[model samples]
Target: MTTGMEELAARMRDFAQAREWEQFHTPKNLAMALAGEVGELIGEFQWLTPAESSSLDEETFDRVRSELADVTAYLVRLADLLGVDLIEATKAKLEENERRYDANLYRGSARKAPH
Candidate 1:
């Protein structure tokens, strides 16, 4: 069956098509731009409280949205390039999480390493 991941990817592709940007989305270029976006995200929180980070002004909001779009675009492109079934991957991760963080140990406990 078709999945949410597939639909989101198709929508992303359609967005690129509408913008005529597919020509510029080479994997290497996208990866480089993705790092830039991540840096921008980190820049927002540098030496700031969670409250301060949450109270971003309009320019910061726009920067965050643009950078988040970059991250999502890069991730979707990578997932597509790798032929990964992301829904399946997500499910697998959840299953692994359940095994690793069993209720007896991690439920309502302090956030510590699994080991």
Candidate 2:
């Protein structure tokens, strides 16, 4: 079964191709937009604590989701345009993170990695 997100991603790709926007969707530009959308997403919880943010009404939560979806949409578009394997990229990054946060040193710890 085709999930909704996958369908949406396909539609977004088709739309981009129809508009010839691929030329403008460079990695740098998409990355900047992703950051901006993330900032907007974070702004929604600017001063809210984990509890407060988590306790928000569904409507507020939906706003956060909307921002997150925007970020994800652009990232998906970039990956499609560049032929990037997002699944592979994500796994590679997580493996890098696991190596950096070695179990012996970071087991159950949440400290930032050394600078």
Candidate 3:
């Protein structure tokens, strides 16, 4: 069963292949692109207060959405290229986090777990 993210990764693979862009899609390049996209996303919220960030106006929200898509595309493509299953990795990370940051111990706190 192909997950939606898997399908999207396939589509991205095809997109790059069709454009002969794979040569430019090295892991380092993709990671940098993903970081740039995240920076763009952050820019959309840079001047907004927490409340304003949460309640973005339509135009700002759309820009944020587009940046998020860019970030996700690079992430998915990078993971696919490296043979990493994003879904499984995310699940495993979530399980690890559940152990590391027990809700009973960390609820409503912003502090990092003790190392």
**Quick one: best TM-score, which candidate?**
3
Which candidate gets the maximum lDDT versus the true structure?
3
lDDT of 2 by residue, 5-64 (tens): 567669887887899987778888988888999999999998999899879889889998
In order, candidate lDDTs are 0.78, 0.83, 0.92
| Candidate 3: residue 6 lDDT (0-100) | 87
Ranking of predictions according to TM-score: 3, 2, 1
TM-score, one value per model: 0.65, 0.78, 0.93
Error of 2 at 83 (Å): 1.8
Q: Higher TM-score: candidate 1 or 3?
A: 3
Pick by lDDT: 1 or 2, better one: 2
Model 1 lDDT per residue over 1-115, tens place? 7676687788877888899988887777777777877887888678778897889889888988887877876777767756777678999998998898877877676666465
- Give candidate 1 misplaced runs (Cα > 4 Å): 1-4, 11-32, 108-115
